[model samples]
Target chain A: MASFRSSLPVYATTLDVVWHYAFRTICGAILVFLVAPILVIIPLSFNAESFFSFTSGMVSLKPEAYSLKWYRDIFTNGMGAPEAAFGWSWLVDSWRHGQWMLALRNSVVVGVASTLVATALGTLASVGLSRPEMPFRGLIMGLLISPMIVPIIITATGLFFFFSSVGLAQTYLGLILAHALLGTPFVVITVTATLTSFDRSLMRAAANLGASPLRAFFSVQAPLILPGVISGALFAFVTSFDEVVVVLFLAEPDQRTIPRQMWSGLREQVSPTILAVATILVLISLAMLGSLEMLRRRVERLKTETPI
Target chain B: MTAVELGTEGLERRLARAERRGKLRAFLLVAPLLAFVLLSFAMPILTLVRQAAYNTLVSANLPETTALIADWKVDAPVPEPLCEALVREMHAAKEVDPAIPSRIATFVNRERAGSLSRVKQVANADIKAPYCAGLAALHDDWAQPDIWRALKIVAPSFSPRFFLQALDFRLQADGSIRSQDSNEALHLMLFRRTLLVAAGVTLACALLGFPVAYLLAHVSLRVSNMLLIIVLLPFWTSLLVRTTAWIALLQQNGVVNDTLVALHIIGEKGRLEMMYNMFATLVVMTHVLLPFMILPLFSVMKGINPNFTRAALSLGATPSTAFWKVYFPQTIPGLGAGCLLVFILAVGYYITPALVGGQSGQLISNIIAFHMQKTLNWPLAAAIGTILLAGVLLLYWLYSRLVGIDKMKLG
Candidate 1:
């Protein structure tokens, strides 16, 4: 019964013990592979030097080896008169002139705009698709979701040709529409999932109690399925916020978004400012992941409390 | 009529009417998004495919030259009419738009490099009639037959030459198709590498994901939930953040090399070249895509009844035998779904490869981007995209068939 491998049973052969340990090692390595690259840059983003690598000072955990310079550079890089005293005017200057700030505003505007459009449409379609009476459900779902599955390059190429021909290329509206198209599937899937689990008898009960279809929906269906709608919107936001290829094809110099900015930063130059931005993005995603987990548990609780 | 009096047929008709009305209401709900997708998403893709077959680059700007060279022999001396058309087109190009000549220059310049200055010089010159003689007088390069041939190739509003170029085949002057000569294998090589990388990533994902997924599926609920977060957190993370992290970790003066040096495992001079090579591409991509492989496989593995494997273990079968013969077969659907999803994704991958995959790691998508942005060869770019799109959609179709896409999940 003496054993180094806790998971292996006493009757297991020597080969079983070896295989069991080896399996654990492989799984451990794979987990590390998944998580390490993401965690490795957190410390590096705070590097005192402009270099992407660690310094001896950093390795030795010297207090002076960490700095917030790159984080400041995100605001100061393209700001006019960045050396001016910090004030409301500095905030205004950053809003107007800072390159990364402009990209941040553009990303937020585009992400919110696209998420709103895609979520509205996707939720509506999902409602229809979830209806038992819906026709050609498979084919329509395929068409709606095809954008997510298609290689982004093909979509970008097509958009370049189509948008340029239609005079929509390089416009903010065009980029929003492109992102909305890409984000639609996520919204559709998530919202549809919540709707599929929704109990129909509650709607029937509301109707039986003299509630109008619209009123019943707003009161009964809306509250119960709200988590899916919100999660789907979040998904759409993240999809648009992280997207760059279509933006690269469609956006003009001024219409740059965060991902587009990071793309150029990575390609034209590998600067630590990008690492700083990435660190912020990682924090945002972590927050989103936490909220999604909570929403998921909420949905599960609601499901269990509801009758069949 | 009362149901008892109406009988079966009437009842059936009434039910059908109610069903149709429900269907109408449902269709109305979806109609707006359907129209939007059809007009925007589907139409743009169609436009992209159309570009590969028909383009207006030459026919729009070089109308006169295109008309004049419609029937010109490639091997023969430059005709007077063709020269006059070129002169007239160049002369009128300024009035139409000053950039037209350069556009034409770029269109033909790609075919034969030196033809740009010849086109520009003739456009700038105030040469009088005896236009053919004037063209010859302007420069000896202008007298070349190859310039005329370049015009012939690009002149048409409709041509399959782009697709030909994409496939590493060229249309000869005599209207024959032939393979591009040696060293012109750039397109073919890219196609090969795209598929190879996709396949390799799929295989690597399978190897790495299988154990992790199995462990998640088999473990206690509390342990599995904790491990699942470790898997899903990365999925929620931004892709560029992750790629940058890899660069920081793998770069020569980065943490990994520094650690190796500190440990005396390798000398400072012996630091490995990892970032911007195929090694980085495969490793980074495998890391990025591992979650995709694991999630679907884990979902499938979770559904499997443990007793089936336990029964096999209790029987004559050894642990490995039980795994291979009984347990593995049941995970095929999940494995198939994960593999196809990863392969489809990997095939069209751009961001990871572009960032990590240096020159040796560049895929067809990068080349396509180059043509679209830098080279400005829209037709050829469209052709390559069409090829890549076709492959991806085929695998997607296979995925839908093998594992219904509705069954696809996200965490």
Candidate 2:
């Protein structure tokens, strides 16, 4: 195929090559445009000065021009005594008083709690949904996934009234349930996709071998689909971690997550600390993307290697 | 009957029972999630929609007053009995909760602004015998028939007042609806602008995403996969971070302007105001939502048999003709899916526009947030939410019809 493509017909001319180059160039530029803004913040986050733009010293590659001040400020900004000697007490003070630290704690707690709920519920539902015997599957699936399709504002407003009435508003549990609802759709989609190619006969084979249905699922299905489940959980975690709209309406001051904190920071005050946060978030996303990619490749490999 | 027939009948019955149990087991597995979603997700939205058309704020607090006012003629003077009921309810409510009268006043003021203080003044006034005269003495505006008419309109326990208001209409005392005055007709215009912006963003995504998707689809798998990661990076990035990046690049003293100034594209003093406006919203949204468009298009385009275009060209059709007739026609499903997805997402965009969208750029979502948080007007917020939800569901239905919801994928 490569040789056939290289030995083009006489009709294939320089104009075709030029058009191909132009198309590739446009695509490359668009990709750069997509990734550039994300990369732009990294250097700006490290700037010794608080400005968004690069200083001449930084452009000239002066080692003195860059500092970790903003990154340090992520922890030390709200500390009682930044000038205090580095010790456990200073760390404790930062943990207690730092805005970003509080947000980080809230984000992890909410993200993990929501991801757990979403993954459990979503995985079970996908198992049932993928079953041929499931009833009202289309309508039920649509309703289950509508959280992703519905506008966050509507969901938030609805949740605000409902949660306020139920005494869930401004509470950690309320935010957890709300984030879980939003994250479930991703879990459902990813897991469902994995199950589409899944062979059902393996379960029957295990059952014939005297394994109970639950045991069969654990031994036969779960191991094979573990990559999908983990990826789905990761997606759920990301959804909850990055979520802000619902949190804006539902969370109290103490429950503010990283994205929620960044929202207020960007809106009320534009600070280099937010850029530092953004850079950190970018790194987190990079890690997530890397893992998702690995899981996807593993799933593909598993699908091919295993037979019914 | 033979013994063999009896055994076969028993076996068939047992098999039927097992099948039923299997179905039940499957349903039971899904039931918990369905129930959780129903309580947490569906019920709240239903409550919001219901609240839009149902408010008991006035009727609940001022029950006797509301009842008495309902019997009065629209153009008639404030009846003496109605004034007595009002005074009775105010004193009674004041004893129960000090904020009740003020809450009722605020509720009434929603129908007719500036009536709260007038109502408050009456509630505060010391009254002698013949309470109507004393009420009129407390506030001169009390004697006007329109104030009384406004009270009657909002006095209903179940009212379409918020929904009407959301639609840019006012409910009159005569049980008729009329268009709101020009100054108050904000929602309809906002809804129109929201649709326009969503449509514009969809078009922009399609225009920009098509080439990239085409390149990804036609390239070697190794190259495409590498490029796909670049596209997915922003898709996975935090929305706030992306919006902040836009702010850094687009703000007056940000990188873009600085670069332009150094290159002498424009004078340093004439740095463009580019951050907070409709243009910025569109540009940034297109950037943020482009991946949504690209991914779907790429998936579909990748599935297209390249042989069709080759065959068309071999049949002596021009390359453009082959693309237009053969390749482009096949990509319509992807186009439809991508456009609908982008438009639906754009319609509900809150954070991006909130950060970058200034006055003119603001969508209906922003206004909904404003009412929910700022104005403390829950009914109006609910009403706006209901309309936005209706629009989204309609588009969603169309999308599911065009591209099955089950087929939707995320990175």
Candidate 3:
């Protein structure tokens, strides 16, 4: 059976080459599959046509002929703004102008507010739990992480009821608090992981030299873990920004999030304006995530470069 | 408060005192979370549990009757006291809201299903005679078997009937628990299907991710880093955007079909079915979760020493055998971590499935959403939510036991 390999059309050299390349190509193709849908939205957003189809200009890769009509429609109602009923003028106008300036503004506000609150609380908890002698650290960690593990849908459902009962259901503060609660787990996990790499001896050395604990923490330890804290903060931002299900259950028309808006648009109607919005969101999220990743890599590098 | 600052105490003794202080500090740190959990999480759960039992719709609607009939027995007729209570309560309910009868009828009618005759018997009965007026003064026997059964079903202060209803089982006319629908299939089937879909998505992710992870791990760092960026790129986008992008690409007149038609894969006939189907759901879900699997596996594989396969090969094992026997086992923990994380995540996924899957692909969570939002069936939703929570906790417990969580990392 082994000797019969020579009878095949391909030689051993060919077989070895083909087999190795096949898996690599397959991997590359799978990666592309995972990413292409997101990438395609960029071009689709710029198409001159009213429909989802890529026109001849877009297909030929000629940027000059392509229209920013969608972008214009997104803002300033370039396509002659569709008349919105039921006081949904903001959504309709947003769809028309190809402009997400307001949504972006709202998202940033919500995301930043949530990130700050979540990160502060998470950092405090992580710091307090950082010491080895802390009692019930495991249980505290479990409770902190429970919000992350319990399905968001379940949490959203329960929170909707709870918030509604308390008369805070659709209020901005309620949504912000919910987002912060949801975003806290990411902050806690990332900060705790960062804390694991902190060299306590440096802090102890500083304290021994008559530096206050707070001073030592700021001057010595904070510098080392700042990257983690920043990355955690960014993670919190992303968590709040991209969150949909909970926001769907909680946010009102006045407090409509981009994701919730997108959900309504997709389900209620199909429009290219959503594609434009999506592409822009993709760009922003990519920027945020790229920086977060770079910071994390820096932390990793710092950990490795430091000597015992 | 440095331990060194303390006078006359030895280092270890001071350290122990510091340790005690640390414990106190930790308790103080977690006190807020404890309070939040007790008020937010614990109270909500308790409320959900409370909602699962006791028939309060009628009682809340007729407060006077509920108060008067607090000690009323099962076989007792409409006593004068209860009749007066019912009249006052009904009048009060009507005064508060003229729509109380329809609401009360909805509640009462829910209690009597498929036994309209039995329900009518109770509705028409009158026991007031000359003592009271209106409903009570009619002087007819209103007590019926179906009403009694409905009352009995709801009599328990903490009934598991919501759980049963959540599973699509309900108390039947004969008082035996049976399927809610005549089809005899429980909604557990939906939960099972959701699990199956989740499992399928996880399996797909693992299969597709393993090769990519292996390639990335074994490749040059420059190549691997580039590949890693490509893998990480998807995380930078919103899930809603990604899902909608698939719709743009997969819809009937969308890019995919347009390309396929151009390439002669199919005439326009096969386009419409692709977008709102199970295949689209599985594809989108697998795409979304692939990174989750690959990142963990890649990190684990990167940490694995390549010499194991070489070591096996030097001992005369075939290349395939060496790879299978030596290399694969080292990645089990990573595989388990990825599988667990991806499966658990995919099972709870709501939006992607709802947007793409439509009717056929809706999961248990979608149904839970429906009950909570649309139907206002909080008890049923809570029951399902509790079941799902239990399932997740059990899975986590199983996973922790099977592979120590401390050693496993999720990306």
**The best candidate in terms of lDDT:** 2
Q: Let me know the TM-score candidate 2 reaches against the reference structure.
A: 0.97
Would you list the rank order by TM-score, best first? 2, 1, 3
Worst 10 residues of 3 chain B by lDDT: B136-145
Q: Give each prediction's DockQ, rounded to 2 decimals.
A: 0.76, 0.83, 0.49
lDDT (10s digit) by residue, model 2, range A1-308: 33433735556667786676677788888898899999999999999998888888888999899999999999998788988998999999999999899999999999999999999999999999999988788888989989999999999999999999999999999999999999999999999899998899989999999999889999989998888899989999999999998889999888899999999998887789999999999999999999999999998898788653
**lDDT of each residue in B273-368, candidate 2, tens digit only:** 898999899989999999999999999999999999999999999999999999999999999899999999999999888999988789999999
Output the number of the DockQ-best candidate.
2
Q: How well is candidate 3 docked (DockQ)?
A: 0.49
- Model 2: per-residue Cα lDDT at residue B6: 100
Residues A86-130 of candidate 3 have per-residue lDDT tens digits of 246756656545325555656778888988888887777777777
Q: TM-score for each prediction?
A: 0.94, 0.97, 0.87
Model 1: per-residue Cα lDDT at residue B24: 99
Q: What is the overall TM-score of model 3 with all chains considered together?
A: 0.87
True contacts kept of each: 0.73, 0.81, 0.50
Tens digit of per-residue lDDT, candidate 1, span B1-411: 777877887889999999999999999989989998997899999999998998786777668778878878777777888788888777787678888788888777867777888877878898878998888899877777887787788788888888999999987655778898778669999999989999999999999999999999988998998899899878988888888889889989888988899999999899999999999999988988999999999999999998998999888788779999999999999999999999998989998989989999898899999899887888899999998898888888888888986887787
Which stretches of model 3 miss by more than 4 angstroms?
Answer: A1-14, A60-65, A77-102, B1-15, B33-46, B54-85, B92-104, B113-144, B155-157, B172-175, B183-186, B400-411
lDDT of 3 by residue, B15-111 (tens): 8888888789777866665565555555655565556554466667666665555465555654666656655565566667767654555544555
Give a tens-digit lDDT track for model 1, residues A1-308: 56485667777778878887888798888898888888878888899998888899998999899999999999998999899999999989988999999999999999999999999999889989999999999889888988989989889989989999999999999999999999999988888889989988888999999999899989999899899999999999999999989999999999999989999998898789999999999989989988998999999999888565
